[model samples]
Target: MMEFFIQGVLHPLLMPAHLLLLLALGLLVGQQGVGALKPLCAVLLLSVLLACVSTLHWRLRLDLEVALLVCAMVTGVLAVLRLELPRWPLILLGILAGVLVGLDSAAPRIPGLRGHKIHMLLAGTVLSSTLIMLICALLALMLRHLLEGIVIRVLGAWIAAGAILVLALYLLRDRLA
Candidate 1:
């Protein structure tokens, strides 16, 4: 149980797609200034919680990785562009990213792990994911003044490029397999 919980906690940090989407969302929200933080965070939290709960009953049988990568790519591009988007769009993006993260972070079906144990695993994931998002957003906000926003843009570009590369490799691997 402890091991499963620990795995859940580390899921976002370990998964490339999850990490990228979180970072991209954080950076984009942070770039929008303090005003955008509350709404986006609220939306993200609600969406993630709902999606995680839904995963316990019926896991979506779709290419969630590809969807996550695409969301990350779009968010990264938005960050790089530094567009001053209105609050609604940012909130919408937050919701989308949160749901994807939650859906993809479902615990693997291991033998004998049932009921409360699975919930504990997902609880850890939710806690860690939320913390990571908050930390990333706060860090970006703090560094915004020091770097004249260049660092955020660079990170966003890197995230976008990385997503594209990974997506390509993932698709090719599927074909080859």
Candidate 2:
């Protein structure tokens, strides 16, 4: 269990793309104000649950890595603009991001956990994904409280810029190869 939990936490932390998405989500939620945070979190969690379960029997052929970069771009732009979008749109964003991350993280086994059942892997991935979102949201909340809305927008711009660079590299990789 400990192993699964740690692996869940570590994988996203170690992956730059995932890290950026998590943080960007946090910043977006943070900018949305405290009243909206809980519902957004709930929506995101539900989305992750559905996505992970869906992955057990199916994997989308969509380029998840590129999708992640795209997520970063969208979320970053939202944050940068400090858009006061309506509730449904924000919920949709969470759902989209949750599905993307869950799909990417739902591999059947971790490096040394070959004997573990697929269900176990899914649980751990869900847990880890939840943690990443929670921590990022919490940090963004703090930053918002301390630094004001402008700072959040700045962070969002940075996130989008980083995503652009990554997306470009991935798109160009085949050509380079």
Candidate 3:
């Protein structure tokens, strides 16, 4: 039980796609300025909860990795550009990102991980993912003042490049195999 919970907590950090999406989304949100933080956070929390519950009940087998990478690429580009987007678009992106993260973070169908144990794992994942997003966003926000946002933009570009490479590799995986 404890082991599963720990695994759940580490899922987002361990998964490359998940971590990239979180970082890109966080930088994007941070670049949106302080005014957008609260609402985006709220939307992210709600969407993540709903997506996780839906995944648990429905067990949707969607190939969310590609979707997640696409999102990361878009967000990374947006961050690199540092566009001053309106509130609605940021909220929409937040919802999309939150849902993707939640869906992808679902516990694997391991034997013996039934009942409350599964719930425990999910709970830990949800908590850790949310906290990591918040922390990364806050870090980006702080760095904006210290470095005149250059560091953020550079990180965004790196993220975009990385996502593109990984996405290409993922798409060609079957061919490679």
Candidate 4:
């Protein structure tokens, strides 16, 4: 049993398990049910811990997507609160943040854009990436405002996405089982 545990499980693949737990925690918090805050706080705290773990000298690297997702959520919440801020700018910032630190393979190379002035080039790339996310979010906010009828469509899309993810999880679980 111990050998089986060591070889088949308790490895890097557990990362997915961690993500699933995070998703469940977020959805539960959004629901605002009993004991919600506890789990929400725990999830947020765990995320921070995971992020920190990735930064240390150990071999394991924290996944960039987790960091991006956390940042995205934080910025999203902030954007909603600070309605006065230009929406497009905020969205563009978000996209840049997401792409730069998003654990995507292409993110790091972008910093080397300029031949000799690597620092300047990288900074520009990061700025551009963030600008794109902010733009997208801003556009989304604008569309939400302009077409009142589009909200239904937005809601439907969100629901459909959730359903698809659930189905995917179920299929994966079945295969594993």
Candidate 5:
């Protein structure tokens, strides 16, 4: 914490601090634990500050990043309670999901699938995917106006950015558990 304070708004510490807070908030919701709220609030504050301070493009993309995290946590809980997919199935789902998300993100506008599962549980693959679209759309509309085909750039960046995020999650898993 002191390291982050000293580094001020621009420190690498701030992003992780923010992510950890955001993840903790999800965990608290998952467990229905009330105690985590204080820290979670702190983390969000740090993330906001970091975005203002850091020059990194990813920092500017925090809202989309956090939106994806929230959606993932929601789907994860539902997956645990309902899907019960075996480890292999989970792996396959991960692979296929990566592809779908890539498609969803990269495409200029996502087409409606008449009977996709997103309509069923209302918690299907596309539900979370839609959340990503909504957040990205808002970000794109606000950030640029050049017909940048900007959403595709964001989509690609999010995927690559997600790979890096997995490393952070790995650290969180090891350190926290």
Candidate 6:
């Protein structure tokens, strides 16, 4: 039980793509000002719930790894560009990111989780994802407040580079496999 809980907590942190996307998203949204945070977080929670339910029971067949990479790339670029999108668009972006992360994190069929109740596993997954997202957002907000804006842009560049490299590896996965 402790092991499963730890696995759940580490799920987002363990995945490079998800980690990058969450951090990039937090940075991007943090730039949008304090007013955007509430709606963005709400959408994130809703999207995660939707993904967990759908992916677990229905086995929604989508290339979620690629989708997560793509999300990371887009959010990274948005951070680098420092483009101030309207609040609504950022909310939409949050929803999309949450869904992708949820799908990627849901591993109901994994060996450790095989005998666990679906709801129990999903609850852990959701909790971990939300915790990570909030932490990322808070860290981004702190950095934004503490340092010059250029630092955030540099971080964005690094995130983008990481996403690109990961995407390349994923593309070549067939050969690597």
* Per-residue C-alpha lDDT of model 2 across residues 47-133, encoded as one tens digit per residue: 887988887678876768988989989999998887787889888888888888888876663466555455565676676766777
Query: Model 4: per-residue lDDT, tens digit, 49-160?
Result: 3332332223334445444444434443432332334334433432343332322212123444444333333233333333332333334444444454244234334433
Weakest 10 consecutive residues of candidate 6 by summed lDDT: 110-119
The root-mean-square deviation over C-alpha atoms between each candidate and the true structure, in angstroms, is 1.6, 2.7, 1.6, 15.0, 21.1, 2.6
lDDT string, candidate 3, 52-128, tens digits: 77777777778899999999999999998988999999989989988999998776777765567777777777777
Provide the global lDDT of candidate 5 against the true structure.
Answer: 0.33
TM-score of each: 0.92, 0.86, 0.93, 0.31, 0.23, 0.87
TM-score of 6: 0.87
lDDT of prediction 1: 0.86
Positional deviation of residue 77's Cα in model 4 after best superposition, in angstroms = 11
Candidate 6 wrong stretches, greater than 4 Å: 110-116, 145-147
- Whole-model Cα lDDT of every candidate shown, in order: 0.86, 0.79, 0.84, 0.35, 0.33, 0.78
| lDDT, model 3, position 57 | 76
Clashes of each: 0, 0, 0, 13, 0, 0
lDDT of 1 by residue, 1-177 (tens): 787678778988999999999888888888888888788878888888788988877897887999999999999999999988988888888889989999987667788865778887888888788777777888888876656799999989999999999999998996878
Candidate with best lDDT:
1
Alpha carbon deviation, residue 117, candidate 6 (Å): 3.8
The better-scoring model by lDDT among 2 and 4 is 2
lDDT score of residue 22 within candidate 6: 82
Q: Which of 4 and 6 is the better model by TM-score?
A: 6
